[model samples]
Target: MVRAAARLPLFFLAASLVAGFLLRAPRSQRVDSEAARQSPRARTAVAATGELVKSLRIGGTIGTLRSAAIRAPELRGSHVVGWAVLTLVRLADAGSSVEAGDVVAEFELKRLEDHIADLQSYVTQAQASLRKRRSEIRILQGAWQHEALRARAESAKAVLGLPTAEVLSAIEAEILRMAAAVARARGKRQAEVERLRALVIAADLGYFDVWIRKELLHIERHSRDYKRLRMKTPIGGMVIRETIFNRSGEYAQVKAGDRINSGALFMRIADTSQMVVRAMVNQVDARTIRVGNRAVVQLDAYPGLRFSGHVAEMAALASPRRGTRSAGRMFIRQIPVRILIEDKDKRVLPGLSASVDVIVSMGQRGVLIPREALQHETGQQAGTFVRVAEGGEYRKRHIAVQGLSDTEALIRSGLAPGEQVLLKGLPRDQRR
Candidate 1:
C-alpha cells in the first residue's frame, strides 16, 4: 500500500509540469511577434531632378604679368679699379612712375679722364709717324730722278762716240740701283697711307664705340652692374621694383668687370593694373576645362568673398612630371591654366593664394542620389534596394544607377522619380 501511494504522487507531478510547459510556449511566441511589429521602420525619399555637377577643385596663386630687377648699364666707361660707389643718385624709386628716356642714376666721372687722355696721345703719335714717312719717301724719289737723267745722258754720249764704254756701263749701273730704291720708297709710302687711313676711321668712330654700345644695352637688359644708370620704362605703368642705393654716400656693389652676356636679367617691370590666377590641372582634367569656361575663385586671405573669373588659357603640353601629389616634380600629364579676374582691386597682389571651381557642365534635370546608396553585386552589375510598402511590411527591390560624381550619382534605370528609397538605415533582414 505504501509503494502504490508514492507512484500516484509521482504521476500527478509529471502531468502538472507538462501542462505548464505547453502554456508558456504560446505566450513567448506571441511576445516575439508583437516586438517585431513595433520595430522602427526606415524612412526614404525619391531621386529627383537636379543640375549637372562637376569635381576636381584646386588652389593656386595670383601673379603679375611681368616682373624685373633694374641693374647698371654695360657701356664701356672709365672703369675705376678699386673705386667703390661714392653715392647713388636715384632718379626713380620702387613703384615710381617713369617715362621713356628718363635718367635713373648717374655715376662719378673723375676716373674716366685718364683713359680719354691716353686715347688723345695715341692719335697725336699716329699723325706724327705718318708725316715723317711721307718726307722720307719724297727725298728718295728726287735721288732716283737724278740718277735716271745721268744714265740717259751717258747712253746718248756713247751713241754719239763722245763717251767711253766704261762710262756708259757706270751710268747704267747707277740707274738700275736708283730704280730699285724708288720702287722700295713707293711701296713704303703706300703702306703708310693705308695705316693713316685706318687710324682716321678709328678716331672718327671713337675708341671702343661699338663695343661700348653693345655692352651698355646688354647690361641694361641683363646685368646689374653700372656706375651711372638711366631707365626709360619700356612699358608705361609703374616701376614694380627698383634697387637704388638710398644713402648719400652708399654705393651698390657690382661684379668686378663691366661686360655682360645675353639672357642676363637685370631689372623687371610689370603691369599691375590687372591680375590673373594661374592653376595647374592634370592633363586629363585640363582638357575638360577649356578656354572661355566660367570659374569662381576664392581667396584664402579674404574670407567669405568670392571673385569671378574666366579661363584665359590652357597649357598645350603636360608638365615635366606625373601624379598630383608630387610637388615640383615633372608632370608627364599635367598642364597649367590661367584664369583672368573680372574685377581686380588694390588688394590683389602677385602670388596671393586662391582656390578655383571650374564648371564642367550644368543642367536642371537628372535622377540623382547620394553616392553611398549604390551597392555592388557582381562584375559591372551594381545596384541598390528601394523599400516598397506592402501589407504594412517593407519589401526591398533592386535597382540600377549610373552617372556618378564625388558625392552623388544618377539612377539611370533603377527607380522612377517620386518613389521612396531607404536612406537612414536598412531593415534587419536586408542588412548587408
Candidate 2:
C-alpha cells in the first residue's frame, strides 16, 4: 500500500511537468512572431521625384590664384663672395598680414655689410692709385719733352761747328764731321727712347684704368646684394611659411635662425581675394569636364562652408597615377584640373583640403534615390533591385537606372514617388 502511494505521486508530478512545457512552447513562438512584425532591421527612405542633378566630385588642395613665393636671396654680387649659406635672422610670422613692399624676411646683414664695406674701401684705394698713376704719366711725358728739346739743340750746335770746320784745316774738318754725326746719332737714340717710354706709359695707364673699373664693379655688385638681403614682398597678402630642409637636413617649416640655400623658396604670400583648387580627374571623365563649367567647392576642414567656382583650366595631357599600381597592362591616368573660386572669404586659405562638385548635367525630372539603396541581384535573377518596405517586411523589385551621379541614382522604372524603400536589404525571410 506504501509503494502504490509513492508511485501515484511520481506519476502526478510527471504529468504536470509535461503539461507546462506544452503550454509554453506556443506562447514563445507567438511572442517572436509579434516582435519581428513590430521592429524593422533596415532603415527606409521615401522615393522622390525631383530634378536629378549629376555632378562629378573630385578632391583637391586649395591655393591662391595669385601668390608670390619668397626665396632665399641668391648671392648675386660676386662669384667669389662670402656667406655661401643665407642665415635667416628675422622672418615674418606665418599667417601675418602684410602689405606691398613690406619686409618679409631679414638676413644677418653683418657679413654682407662688412663685405660691402671692404669692397668700397678697395674701390677708394684703387681710385687714388689711378689718380697717382695719371700724375706720374704726365710728369714722365714732361721730362721726355725737355730731353728731346736738349737733343735738338745739341744737334744744331754740332751742325754749326761743321760749317766752321769747312773754313779750317783738313784735320779740323774731319773732327767736325765726326762730332756732327755723333750728335745726330745721339738725338735719334733719345727720340727712340722717348717713343718707347711713351708707349710704356700708355700701357701702364690703360692697365690701371681697367683695374679701377673692375674694383668699382665689384663694389656695385656687393651693394646690390646688401639690398637683397632685406627681403621684401612684392604684393600685399598673408604670409605662409614653407617647408624646407633645415641645417640638420630635415624638412620643416621655415623659421628664424635657419640656414637656407641660395634661391630656395622659404615662404609665400597668398592673395586671399581669389582662390583656386587644383584637382585631378580620371581620364575617363576628362572628356566631359570643360573649362567654364560651374562648380561648388566644399572644404573638408569646415564642413559647413561652400564656395562657388568654375573650371579655370584643364591639362592637355594625362599623367600616370602616382603611388598606385596597375591591375594588369593598363594603368590609371589622371588629368589635372584647376578650378577658380569666385567667392571671397577670410577662411578660404591656401593648402586647405577641399572637394569640387563639377556640375556635369543640369536638373532633369526623374525618380531618384540614394545610390546605396540600390542592390544587384545575383545568380539566375540578374538585374538591379531595391527593397521596398510594406507591412513590416521588404519586397525586392527590379528597377531601371537611367543615370547615376556621385551620390544619387536616377530611376527610370519599377519605382514610384513617395514609396518607402529600404536603404539596406534584409535576409530571405524578412524580404519577400
Candidate 3:
C-alpha cells in the first residue's frame, strides 16, 4: 500500500505524543447521593500518581538505514549502441527476503544465448581454418625446398662441365659454356622462390587473422550482452521494484511485458537489520530535533505498539517538500530527519508509514488524573477546570494542566493528590 507522509507533523502539534513516561489515569468512581445531594452532578474520581513527558511527533516512513537500491543492470559504460530493451521473464516478488548474489530479475536470454552459440561455432570454425591453412603452407614450402635443391644440383653439374671445356673441341666447348650459363641462371632463381615462399606464409597467416579478429569481437559482444540479461542483488535484504514513469506519462512497476530503457532504475534491495524512520520536520521544529534525541516510533498498521529509537541524522540543508506547490509558489520548507530503530519487530518493513515522537524533556513524578475529569471552556482547548468535592459541596476548581496524553493528564498545580473531582464525558480531540 502506497501513501503520502505529509500530514504527520500536523497530527501532533501541541503535547508530545511520545510514550516515554506512560500515563496511569485513575479509574472513575461512583459517588453515593447519601454523602451529598446538594450538587448532584456526575461521576467522581480520585487523582492518581504518574510521570509525564513532553514530546513532538514527526511523520515519516519506516525504512532500512543502510539500504541499497537494485536497479536494472546498467550497460552505459559499455559499448552498446542504441536503447537496449529487455523482456522480463523471471522476477522476485516484492517484499521477499533475499540473500547476497540472489537473482532479482531475469530477462529473455534465449536470444542472447543463441547469438553466443553462433559466435562459439564461428570460433570453432576459425580454429579449424587456421589449422588447415598451416597444413597447406607446409606442403607449399616443401615443394619450394625441392625446387631449390634441384637448382643447386644443376648448377654444380654445369660448373663441372666448364672445368673440362678447355680440353674439348670448339663446338663442344661453346655448347658447354652456354649450358653452364643456363644452369647458373636457374640456380639464381632460388632467391625468387624464397621470396615467393615468404609471401605464401604471410598470406596464409593474414587470412587466418582476419577470421580471428571477427571471432573475438563477436565473442566479446555475446559475453557482454549475456551478462546484462540477468540482474542480482548485491546484498542480502528485501526486494522492492521501482516504479518508472514511461514516455506515455504513466507510472508502473517494471514487470514482464514491460520494456525498460537503458540505465533505468529497476529494483531496490534494502538492509532489514538496521531500520529507521525518515521524517520531515518543519523549519521551525527542525531546530528542536537533534541527532541522538530519544524518540518513540509508531506504525499505523500495528496500533498500540510503540518502538523505541533515536534520531540518527539531521539534514544539513532545508528544501521545499515535493508535490507541495500551490498558487505558483512553494508551500513549506522541511528538513529531512532520520531516526534509527533500537528494537526489531516483524511488522517493521521498508516503505511502511510511521511516526517518530521526539522526547524534549525528561519525565517527572506528578499528580495525574484522567483527561475526562478536566472540562474545557467553550472556544478553548487548554486550561481544564475540574469540579472538586470540597467543603461538603461540589465546586469548580481551576487547575493548571502541565502535560496531557491519550487517556491521562498531569496536574502541575491546583489539583492535589487524593482529591475528589467530577469526571466528565470525554475530550473532543483524540491524542492519537
Candidate 4:
C-alpha cells in the first residue's frame, strides 16, 4: 500500500497527459491520394518583421564568485575529561553586518576555567614539592660531606699514632698501622657512596623541576584554551550562516546552543562587493553557452528589475544536478556556469533566486519564420525549407538559415517579410 501511495503522483501525471493529449493539434498530413490526411497543415502564419534574438534560458541564484569562510574555534587536541566539546553560548545573527574583532560566537568557558584553576593549583603544589625536595637534597649533601671529612680526620689521627709504633711494642705498631689503613679505606668507601647518593639527588631534582615545568605549561595551554572560547571575525562583512549536518543526517545552519565539532565550518562572510549569477545549463543546451557569452538576469524577488552580465567562467566538468538525489540516480547532468554582473545594484543581494537568459545570437531585424513552417529533413542534402503558398499551391523553398531556436528561426535569406507561409497542412509534393 505504501508503494502504491508513493506512485500516485506518477499515475496522476499519466492521467493528465492522456486528458490533455486531444487538445494538442497534430502537424501536417502525408502526400498522395490516400494520404489526404487527418489535420491538414492549414495553420498558416505570415512572416512578420522584427528583431529576432535567440537565447538559452537557465535558472540559478545570485551569489559571489568568492567568499570568506568563518570557521569554528579549533579545540581538538585539548583533552581533559575525554574528547571535550565547547558549548555554544552566543551566535551572531545571520545577515547581520559584523566588523573585524567582532565576536561571532562564544563558547561556555566555565568548564575550561575550572580546569585551568585545577591546573594552576597542581602547578603550585608541584613547585612547592620541588622546592622542599631541593632543600632536603642540600641538607643531605652537607651531612654526607661532614661524615666523609670526619672519617678522613680519624684516618690522619691513626697515622699520627702509627709514628709512635717505633717507640712502642711490635704488636702495638702493627695495630696502629692497620687501624690507619682501615680508616682510610672506610673514608674512601663513604666518599664513593656519597657521590652515588649525590647523583641520585641530582636526578631526583631534575625530575622534580621537569614535573613542575610540565604542570606550568599545561596551565598556560588551558588558559589559552579558555581564551579561544570566543571566536572573532577577521574582516567586516555580512554574516552568512554555514550549513552543517546535524545528528539526524540533515543539513542545518549553525546556531546558538548548538554543539559543533572542532574546526567545523560555522559561518561565512560573503564578499558582496562583486556579485555573479551562478547558473546550471542542461547538457542539451550546454554547448551553446560559452565563456564571454552575454546574459541578462532577472531576480525573482524583484520581478521588475533586470541586470546584464557576461559569462566569466564555466565548469570544465559536468555533474548530476545537485540538491536532488533522484537526479544522480537518473544520470541527469548539468554544467555549472558563472556570469559576472556588469551593473551593480544595491537591492541585489546574494542567495536571491534568479533566471538567466544567455544570448546565443542577437537578430537585427531579421526575417522570422514560425518553427512549424520549417521542415528539418535528415539526409546528406538535408536542408531547412519552408512551404510557400503561391497561386493555389504550395512550393518548397530551400533557404539559408541564420539561427534557429526552440520556437522560431531567424532567416538570413530566402523568405521575405510579410510573405504567407503554409504550415501544418502541406502540398502533396512537399509532404512525406
> lDDT per prediction?
0.60, 0.87, 0.78, 0.80
**lDDT by residue for model 2 (120-200), tens:** 787788778878988887887888799899999999999988768858999889988998999999999998998898788
Model with the higher lDDT, candidate 1 or 2 = 2
Task: Point to the candidate with the largest TM-score.
Answer: 2
Model 2 worst lDDT run, 10 consecutive residues? 76-85
Report the Cα RMSD per candidate: 18.1, 8.5, 17.1, 14.5
Query: After superposition, which runs of candidate 3 have C-alpha atoms over 4 Å from their true positions?
Result: 1-52, 74-83, 150-200, 206-210, 213-228, 244-250, 323-333, 368-396, 401-410, 416-432
TM-score of each: 0.46, 0.77, 0.66, 0.66
- Against the true structure, whose lDDT is highest? 2
> Distance from true position, residue 27, model 4, in Å?
46
Error of 2 at 297 (Å): 2.1
User: How good is model 4 by TM-score?
Assistant: 0.66
Residue-wise C-alpha lDDT for candidate 4, range 11-71, written one tens digit per residue: 9999989877755424222234346555355668898877777888788888987677766
Q: What is the Cα-based lDDT of residue 394 in candidate 2?
A: 80
- The digit string of per-residue lDDT tens for model 3 on 198-278 reads 987898799788878877886786688678678877799888888877546789776665667656677888888899998
Give Cα distance to truth, residue 331, candidate 4, Å. 6.9
Which structure is stronger by TM-score: 1 or 3? 3
Clashing pairs in 2: none
